[model samples]
Target: MSDCYELFLTCPKSLEGLLVEEATQLGLQEVREQVAVVRGQGDLETAYRLCLWSRLANRVLLVLARFPVQNAEDLYQGVLAVDWHDHLMSSGSLAVEFSGHGSGIDNTHFGALKVKDAVVDKLRTADGVRPSIDKVNPDLRIHLRLEKGEAILSLDLAGHSLHQRGYRLQQGAAPLKENLAAAILIRAGWPRIAAEGGALADPMCGVGTFLVEAAMMAADMAPNLKRERWGFSNWLGHVPALWKKLHEEARARADAGLAKPPLWIRGYEGDPRLIQPGRNNIERAGLGDWVKIYQGELATFEPRPDQNQKGLVVSNPPYGERLGDEASLLYLYQNLGERLRQACLGWEAAVFTGAPELGKRMGIRSHKQYAFWNGALACKLLLLKVLPEQFVTGERRAAGDESRSAPQNEPARLSEGGQMFANRLQKNLKQLGKWARKEGIQCYRLYDADMPEYALAIDLYGDRVHVQEYAPPRSIDPEKAQARLLDALAAIPQALDVDPANVVVKRRERQSGTRQYERQGSEGRFLEVVEGGVKLLVNLTDYLDTGLFLDHRPMRMRIQREAAGKRFLNLFCYTATASVHAAKGGARSTTSVDLSKTYLDWARRNLSLNGFSDKHKLQQGDVMAWLAEDRGEYDMIFIDPPTFSNSKRMEGVFDVQRDQVQLLDLAMARLAPGGVLYFSNNFRKFELDEGLAARYAVTEISAETIDPDFARNTKIHRAWRLATR
Candidate 1:
């Protein structure tokens, strides 16, 4: 073996800078970074030092030979040229790891087999014995990389990758890789913080990877000290005496470092199953006394009074893969931001996430951001110094004329496409402003898909703006959609002259069954606005549907005008906004029926807000079931069912399109002799069946219900009036 040789240190992508810095610090010369590999010149002892101390390296490969080869025969010949007997004994087992493919070596498995065959054939010819292939635990590990007819053969001195530090016996779901975790700590400046005796925390720690790594760094403990198996153990090229001396020195240093006073390293996890694994990992790393993990939710994680007040809080929360409902996760992000602002006053916050759109929900300004990869998924690491000046402009401002805050989340320098959207919003607002002002409407739709490229519905609820983006089709490029969304968000604050904090955004897609009624979050924050002279509470963040339906404003107003001295019935009366208007119109009595208890509670609050107490009634049950059981007659009725429902309380699935006839017949049976029933639905493709229209006097009133705010989108909903002949 040569005294000095070429060493290739492999680490996770985006961490090459840290590894280069580390190698340079360790006295390795000519260190250069390329993707995930760092090339350097070092002696055997320098390689040994890296294997023992590198917290960021996945493997240390010693380059043995390089050649130009093509096809399996050429590859076999090239690998055979290396003197195999000098590395390992002929009787020992070996493992070959092949990466990349070119010039007829199209697959990794085939290329690795060729290299293995060549090595075995050479050893057999030299010593009359062949080394057996051992994939699980090999005596010698070989690495081969082929690219564009060029081959580089190397010996993997670190087996099973240096990342397998032997501390993590169990793992939680989506555990951050150990090396990547170390890279995050290094990038977040944990070394400086540790030197100053400041604290470190991972609120969403998975199996204590960050906690263990942080403690190891603070105490100067070698990362691979606890590992039992290594490729160099049985290699003939390894110097036994030198390795022994280095190993002993590492053990002594680790022991002394472990004895230092702990720098507060703590973690918090909501999952109880993850807590034990985190504790177990810390203990296995010989850091039981230095690192601690407790069970807690993200919203309630706060630094203890006994702990360091100013430090860093870093976490890897879920990235929202879009397979299931994401409403709760949005609230999770929003609440996380709120908690960080409330509790972590002077600390630093670092959040790593794969879904950058979900990151926008946090509402906190990131002063610095770095891009990294978790396997194949592209991710972002956002860093923010939690202080008043660092907060996103207009994040928590309370004012009437809130002049445009900084572009929502630092939008890309105003593009011409963004300027076009700004002009469209201004035109729509001016067109609707006179009508809205004359009618005394405090809440109205300002723009509705006015531009096809920007598929959004912008609504004004007094001072707050609610933006709903329709999910784009699969054929659209994701980056393009994201750019368009950012452009639209950037244009909103400037066009409407409102604060960005007052803007709440949500993605709207076709709902499956009862998912539309599912709770997105529980912020419990409400804004009271007037619609047709009735006071109602609207929540923009908690659920998919705001409490009041702006499209049905004209219908609610008509109910108020026509229900004088008449008994009124509101079916599927979500929040009872229409029923409140009826009560204000001197209805003899009003009854509201719905299947959700939450909406029933909201309905009660709305009635209480308007001083209409005993005469108005709220019924919580399946509206169809309630209609079938009701025996009383009413002079006026409104039946508006959801497009589809699979609620557990319902006897069976309910589809408005398929069951409208039976539903109308049931309501007609309960109608007084001269009473009228109004039916409405939001199914865009709904067509009224002809048989029911022939049986009764049915009038399509969809056009009459279109108000000025919703006139641009004529297909918003369809309405009908029916009465017995």
Candidate 2:
């Protein structure tokens, strides 16, 4: 009976703004963007039009009910409150999709089961027959979201996601999602370019997602034309007459658009097998005449000799998702860049990649980078014009400068805030330089987020400087953070008298457990540096943390001083820097435990470099499990656990704040009488449990553990020496 209904259009993450624009363009009323979804008010025709025409939407859902729901009972009753007989028949099939978690329904499967039970109960009570559950092809699909104790139920107008346009019968390994491909095209201004009669090409098209989506946009083809199923198709409330009329109108529009001059859309693929599938998908989408997919290597990709056209070259290139994928793919990216530079001179390029670092290897400066989500992977769509002037010869410019007269090699002038940050870095260097020289220290932290505006840690590994910019809060403008990062990078080389090439930039985000230890890349270019009179290997580019922790310099030194003629144990030892120091200081034997084979290997190399043999052991296992089994007593022990880790290798999630008491108890049990256990963690808000402190002789030596190099920020790591009461 309602003329219009509240509707929600679900989209891939990071495309809310784009979807909002699309909804506005569709003339939907009260259009607003929410998290990963757009809300609007529209009649049945408006909903049908969006379901047909929207290229960026995943699903068009019609909101049916909303109410407070705390437990499974509340959810079931709330669902029952909606008259199921009005929307679905008792004999029909239905499916419920559950997302998010809350008070009673902690798991999606359980939540879905409860919703299903409620629907079945309501239907059976009314008509003596219950609807059957169909996961694959349901007559009716319901979407339930439990967010912040409120449940919003919606009927999925599009049975499956609109992205599954029914045209993609075949795909290659890691093919881009259709809606994601469309989002990338829109972000790259493909619609505008197509409007001006620009051609479209994909040199590395995987199953032709980009090309097909581009052709559909160019010809105004309804994306859902080939999709056979709709949620309302079997529903009792569906106005079949109205729906048929809308479908005929959409078909007419598609036919009229296709009659115009065909768009120049071509997809080139190196894989011979993928060509057929790509072509099949294009033809199925009814764009066979508008787009072409051909078997061709990236090296041979070029525009047709007769066409003489310039347009956009968009691609969703391989992002090296697996191990060993990067070793070969890095060169692929570089070669792709070369081929584009040689073949397409006037064309603009857009690359959608989950690995931005590999995109960086292309050696092309991206003019705009928009964040998008390819499924769960956070990816970026990089837009750049393929011009000779945009290419860099040596080191890339720290920042884009508009002045042509300025020397390309010269450092760009910093902003006012950047100037102040530079001055502070210089001052810190002056203050720390004397101490580092006097102590014969080759590596140390020069600045630690000294200026809040420039939240970066500048560490000196001999001549090379590692700069890690902390990811700013969501409240801060990303452009402002990028500008500040560039300012810091520009300032470091000039301030420290180091070459720009020696400077490595990395963005540091708050990480949990093993994620902090995961390798960003596998270059494994190790740099030998001296820390606390010990030689250590530190890699700046391959991982988030350099193999060595400069803040723990004092802790390692303390271990060395106390480890003479004593047994040393290092728990959660990454790279075993502490064990190396302990072995060098005359420990009877040293044991280092870590879960990662890569870091364990690095730790072995460190011990060998320090001339400590296998007598000093390195064990690979979960530290907690290892500790529970170990009966050996150690006079000196170091336990440094990650803040939180939900690694599959471990038994359960490890929370340093919650489990520290138990962890400390286990470590203390392994310590001999009067033996010292240096327990430390980098979790900023970590609080020592009162119960554990009361049980043991715990002394908070956090202040004393910070070295002079990290003097500016004493809370880099919290340390305490504990022993049995």
Candidate 3:
């Protein structure tokens, strides 16, 4: 045994650099960083200090030996060569943790077993006394790594992982590890902020991990001071006197730090269930006076510290793992951004998230980004300075002019072609505004590619405008198309007398498979618009199409008109706008079917918004499969499926042209006697199978379904009414 020991400090991936820096600061010499592991040289006291204070390390390993091994026997011999009496008592319990593979030991469990056998065999006495295996509460924890035919054996100086600071016994569904949370706080410059008497807040503080970690850091508390056990506790080389001195020093530093004025640290969670738990965690960290937890929603999360004090707004908002989780989370992130802008101006923000794309929807720019890992999921810590300049107004300036910000009171001037586009928009609005007000319609198409050069479909949803730019053909120069788009966007706000921030833009191209249904953005901004005396929810920014299909206005009205006292069915429901109409029109019952859980969830919200949840049922599955299994009959059925769909949830690709006959037959089977089946699709080349007309009385209602708004595009979609002969 020597006074100096070669040590390996292990941390979560992406924190090796930070660990190296911290270890070096803690007097570790010659520190070298590898992937997830930092190698350095330190004395026994330095190792102990790191176990107590190092915020980023998972384990501190004191290297005992390094030897080459070609097979399992070689590994056994190598372990046996170590003098067991120097480290562990013969009767003491131990645990063996082995990592890596090769040298004929491919399985980690087998490798660990072999190491344990060698250690126990070497320690056995003449009377057969030997160490027993204790996985938990082990007196000695040995770690072995087989790398490139060499075994590196070390003693785990930290008993359990250093991340278990002993405060967070209870956590949320996706609680960040203590060490990782500390790392995030450090990266967010909490130390600097705290030293300046600044405050800290987390709007979505589940279990108060960030709040506790920040308080501990600010109070200069040793992270593992309260940990009851350590791997070196029972080791023969343990130096009690030196350890006692270091522990007392840490305690004194914590006491002195606590004597200073406490920083304003608070956390707010939307879930009331987590509020008490978060307070418990804060109390466990001995920070009850310095921190408080409250039950509050993200929409109303405003952190009020002492007067004139600004700090950091840190949070790990849920980045959903499920398919449709992002859609709902978008608004959460957006709301978070909005709160920061409204309440925390001039303060700093650090949002740690697994979904960086969702972070972009926050409508703010992060000045810096740090990559980290939460277990296996790669994550990012976005650092933002919440200033007015960092706010995104949702308006994209033209290329080469992105740096210039438009004045708040003045609108951007339109180009010559933009003026023409603006005039056309004004003409259409004047013509349609009269009709819209006369009919009491709050949502309708104001412009639909009226000028081909500025190929756009602009719809007015209440006061906001939803603009969809038709992707230019290959023959047109992309730059020209982009210029035209900018022109149209600029003219829209002024031409329609709407705020620029109220416009949402998306590019519309020929979509294949389920691309059309996929989310184009995640702002999750939904607007309620009235049509036919019923309120419907429409998300202007999330999907390629708003939840409400404006072209289907007439058809939905028709459904509402004939729905009185009738059982109605909506196929490929798509947010169930028509079903809501049916429910409002006094339908006996309404069943809406769609394969997309996202849309079904939206449909549920739509139904709930209109107070029609009980009688209107929303089913999630392939429409065809659902129709086949359904045994109920309906007086009126509407089938408005996508032009083509290759959704993975379905058994096979659905070509509306190829599968119409089978689809109609399956749907018509559930249609009651004299029931009307209204079928529609947008495929321009689609031709109804002639055989269907012979079997049932079919009438083309395309003309009747086309409203004045979509009159210019009569072929936008074709509809037909089919009934039994």
Candidate 4:
């Protein structure tokens, strides 16, 4: 026997040359090479040799069954004919793994399921006992492939995906699997270079996979020598004698090939998440005693030991995929490139990136660019060798595919959503008087209110902020909610009297049920008003309410003192503070109106808490529509409508900023000549349409209206005192 055995070696695309070297190094003759795969004849001894030696190959597969099968029926028949019971015990468990083909099969998962069913069905019929199926791990892992319409069934020799490499106890977002890491090292010619005293590294060493892979290759250990078993071990015709000899020989060879000082390998990770996993992987690869893990920003990094020099530096930087901003990721790569020039000299650096912009950032031309697929992500592995002269100067000169970094003095542009939120929140903070502070108040304002997503907060006092989250309103422009939030923040200061910086606005991340994130804009607040020997410091600004509603700010304060020994009326009293003030000031009676049953109940509670009657009239009806049909008289009236109001009960659109004149005119017609009307609006640019001021005593009281907490701006509310002529 010439020791002829079937051999199949898999390589990541673009690394064919490296795989060829690995195969030849294993003493396996390559009778055939097909694109990403190399197939040849080898004995059981040669198979073990390749398993112990090859670093570039994903896995060395041993073909168990090759059939020109087409449909599901053919698949079932071919699987049934295999002498499965010869190697597998009746008590053994099996897992079916599959890949390749779309037109011939609906999907890989479905194809794999069909293959599993066929294998188990065959065993049950022929041997009278079928093995159990294990998805996680199993005694035998069967691999079925339908490629280019040809179905080939092979035993997965590496139990866990070859990527397991027995390393990495942790990981980062979208980490590179271990086998792929080793493949890149071999593909980059690291083994050949390492054998000659060259070095290797990964600057963006996510979980240290590439560095660990390089270390393992440098150690001269078979990638799978640590692995326990393969799918073929349980196959019908498996040669126990040959496999045992091959396994032992591989161990002996690996033991003999150990280097004295170990190849110079380094793995650098800027993210903390990758460090632990990287450490675990290095230890698992039996290289933990050799490799070092570091956590720091790539740009400000200094080499741990200045002595190690002139090897390979590989980095997989940001790719602008499912991450923060695209500009942030780009800046990260740009700074990374600068580091390569400033710190890494007389050395070769390989950058594996999904973003090609990385090569441009390095400011150095790549000698070789290898294209590889990092999980359906088309990526390029760029290689740059720093020559001796270039290394000494340690300065970058821009050339093809490279450029200068962004100038520090240049203006920064924010996303529209971010800008709107920041701008509006700042403006509102400037005018507010009351602040939600942790020491005095507890809930301090968090976000100023800008973001496409909805989140509004009123800091109650520290640790507790009343939070309100609203969705985008239909029938309005998409930016309406955002615009309203800005408007709300701007007007809040006049209503409360707080510094602009004190109010913070943050957008809430939408999530299901209890997992959602909410605002803590204002958690602690100490500002409290005293009336009738009672103290009031609870923050109404931390939630959706921005403390004092500027529209009602003047009205609340007016009613606070004026309602003493007088009748008071509050229409659409959301927080019912005005009605409470009336009762606190010793008013004879009070009435409140709102469509919300929840708020109406709240208004009744407000009156009762202030020693006023719960018997005070509370109407759950549209204010505009209800007042149109009925008449009620009061000694003093405070009517302030929102700039834009739409209710579930009315078809009319109420625009207080624009419709204040007509709205006030109606109130005046119902008012007694001496009965005063306090009218207000929150529209900052509000200008009273001419004739109204002439008809009534309309004095602009905006300047006189403000509280200490809302000191951000005085113009947050527009107020007027009107008495009929």
Q: Which candidate wins on lDDT?
A: 3
C-alpha TM-scores of all predictions: 0.65, 0.57, 0.71, 0.57
Leading candidate by TM-score: 3
lDDT (0-100) at residue 428 of candidate 3? 91
**Higher-lDDT candidate of 1 and 2:** 1
Clashes within 3 Å, all models in order: 0, 1, 0, 80
Candidate 4 root-mean-square deviation in Å? 11.2
Query: Tens digit of lDDT per residue, candidate 1, span 1-725?
Result: 67888999999888899899998887689998999899989999998899988988999998898899867899999999998889988899999999998889889999999999999988885447789989989999999989888998999889888888999989986888888988888888888888888888887887899889889988988899888778798888998899889889999988888888888888999999888888988889989889899999886777652543478888888866432224345556665666666667677888888866656656577888889888888998888776656655244534332232322333223457878999988898888877889889889999888888888888999988888888999988978887687768767777888766677888889998878778987788988888777789999888878898899998999999988888899999999998999988889999999999999999999999989879899999988888889998999999888999998999999998899998999898888889999999999989898898888899999999999888889999999999999
1-725: candidate 2 lDDT, tens digit per residue: 58899999999889899989888888689998888889989998889888888988988898889999878899999999999889988899999999999877889999999889989998884437789989988999999999999999999988888889998989898888888888889989999999989998899987899988888888878888877788888878788888889788888888998999897888899999898898888888888888888889886787662357778999877776543343345446665776666677668999888777667657578999998777778888889897757764333333443222322233334446757877888898888999989888888888888778889888899999887878899999976675566556656666777765577777788776577688888776899988766788889888888889888888988888888999999999999999999998899999999988989999998998878886799999988889999999999999988898888888988899999877888888899897889989888898989897788888999999988877777778899888887
Error of 1 at 426 (Å): 20
> What are the lDDT scores of the predictions, listed in order?
0.84, 0.83, 0.88, 0.62
Residues forming the 10-long window of minimal summed lDDT in candidate 3: 401-410
Error of 2 at 362 (Å): 2.9
Cα lDDT for residue 425, candidate 1: 86
* Ordering by lDDT: 3, 1, 2, 4
Write down the TM-score for model 3: 0.71
Task: Write model 3 residue lDDT over 474-576, tens digit each, in one string.
Answer: 9999767765775676577778887655777777889999897899667787888788988888888778888888998999999999999999999999999
Instruction: Kindly give the stretch of ten consecutive residues in candidate 1 with the minimal lDDT sum.
Output: 399-408
